[model samples]
Target: MAGTNRILVIVTSVGEYEKAGYRTGLWLGELTHFYDVAEQAGFAMTIASIAGGHVPLDPESLAHDVLADLGTDKRYADREFMDKLTDTVPVADVDVEDFDAIYLTGGHGVMFDFHQSAALESLIARFHETGRIVSAVCHGPCGLLDVTLSGGEPLVRGKDVTGFSWPEEELARRADVVPYSLQDRLKQLGASYSTAEKPFATYVVEDGLLITGQNPGSAKAVAEAVVGRLR
Candidate 1:
């Protein structure tokens, strides 16, 4: 309760899965899980997107199997929560000083744009340099891929992190269309990337101020860890 009590929830604005001839966007459960947890802890959230406007939902993420235990049934039925995705604040328009932390929510769509936004990179770098928490879940870590700190090094360099792993990508049957391997990119950047023993199992890593979750199953834990950091 002593912190700023603010959180910026970043989502993917890209919905085109042209490679797979389909569309993908934010994984609803990823956002819902983290949003629910942090909100309960009294954190006010601002949902943002790379380019803003509307955030498409990964159609597969809404499957009953994925949403069954995510506690999102109520959110899916709540227009207030669902409407936040319809018109998200663009990252460039955000006031960096308004938040204490930044959370990147994932879906395959992020693979296309998370690393492409200079504004997002700058905002993340500002958060990192100021000692504010920079966290991501699943493919959301993609946002950190290109962010470089004032010291002239990639923010992820030499840090312990995790996201949707390569094997998990294969398991999710998305290895073919995800643009690039998040696990590989993390390792390529010198991050000590890790994952749960089994794909999709909840896993979170906290290396200093950088927090990351392995998959959607890890979203709640990631947010809890962020809440703990704020406390």
Candidate 2:
């Protein structure tokens, strides 16, 4: 407790596409990668979903090729980490005061549920208004779209932020299936959203206490930025 930072990680509960077969929950690497980086820096983490209970991973994020790219397999293999995902705290049950920051992880599934939850939006607002770090990576920023501060201004209004971009979504082939363009929606909400020049390149933007990363490739960097800020 003396030198530790408690991070509240908000993951999505809905693993949609059940009808079509495959499911999409939080992107595994987005959470695992960030977890590895932050935990290594001595930060404590709590994984939670809007509806609580288990939260799955986007199947593709753990594919052989992806596992070859990200250092997430270890987290997947670690029983302690997997256990956390197996049973997560519901967002409504979380007390903003217990943590120093809130990190929203991403997946296509988040496109279905993250933005719609009023409870999550309220916590995001509370985290920001209290001068705590509010961060997200990839589709994670979707949760920030509807959050309004106690002052009544959109949390991201005029904020320089970056999230999963239209080009990246199109490249991932989920452009047609996704509910809306995360980049476009954030811009419409008055966020000055931008992206990396390369579709999947790592990109992160830190504006005041709100930090956002461009895609899965940027998760660890975003976590590192949060670590630096917390210090």
Candidate 3:
């Protein structure tokens, strides 16, 4: 991969959803799909987490049925890829200048930590201010909630964006378990949020340098959108 094609992939370090009494972390499909797309486009990728080391995988994302259906599950079994998830760089150690784009991967676990990191928020702002591509999928958009550009305006304000919808959250039966509704928060931040008519469908919204996806199904589309922008 060329130096100019470097991409930073950020995933949550949080491993469990205590309130829901279930394991939750990076949604495997979300990260895997986007990663495959980016890598095939000749981009060098680095995995990072809010707290660093041992990024967790949401158990639900690794269900046998889910893995079998996607067929791309071999990515989960790939030793090199799995090893990368075992030890991710801390967000604080990341140099924003090294990447051409920054992507946020999501899971229910992100709702617990993605939005609360001041360091991650600052890195995102820098990425945006410098005109690098900023992309996220599903609950990944939660990371954008508190990001402000150099002029202090919310990054998503007045921008067209989409993430895991409230309806989808409700459909997943995690409405109460999540810390907050990502769709509602993005709307409150002044983003023009939209989604597919049905839950779990592909929906990608690109607003200049920022791109977002509505669900796991939208992950590849979101990455392709970012690749298009980079080109």
The Cα local distance difference test for each model comes to 0.91, 0.89, 0.89
Number of the top candidate by lDDT? Answer: 1
- Write model 3 residue lDDT over 1-231, tens digit each, in one string: 343688999999999986878789999988888888878888889999999999889888998877764554898779988999888899999998889999999998998898899999999999998889899999999999999888889999999999999889899889888778898899999999999888998999988899999998888899899888887
The lDDT, on a scale of 0 to 1, for candidate 2 is 0.89
Q: Mark the 10 consecutive residues where model 1 has the least summed lDDT.
A: 1-10
Measured against the true structure, the TM-scores of the candidates, in listed sequence, are 0.97, 0.96, 0.96
Of the pair 1 and 2, which is ahead by lDDT?
A: 1
- Find the candidate with the highest TM-score and give its number: 1
State residue 74's C-alpha deviation in candidate 2, in Å. Answer: 1.5
Model 3 worst lDDT window (10 residues): 64-73
Point out where model 2 deviates above 4 Å. 18-22
lDDT of 3 at 183: 89
Assess candidate 1 and give its lDDT.
0.91
Report the C-alpha displacement of residue 38, candidate 2, in angstroms: 0.7
> Which of 1 and 2 is the better model by TM-score?
1
Candidate 1 local lDDT, 87-158, one digit each (tens)? 999999998799999999999999999899999999999999998999999999999999999989999999
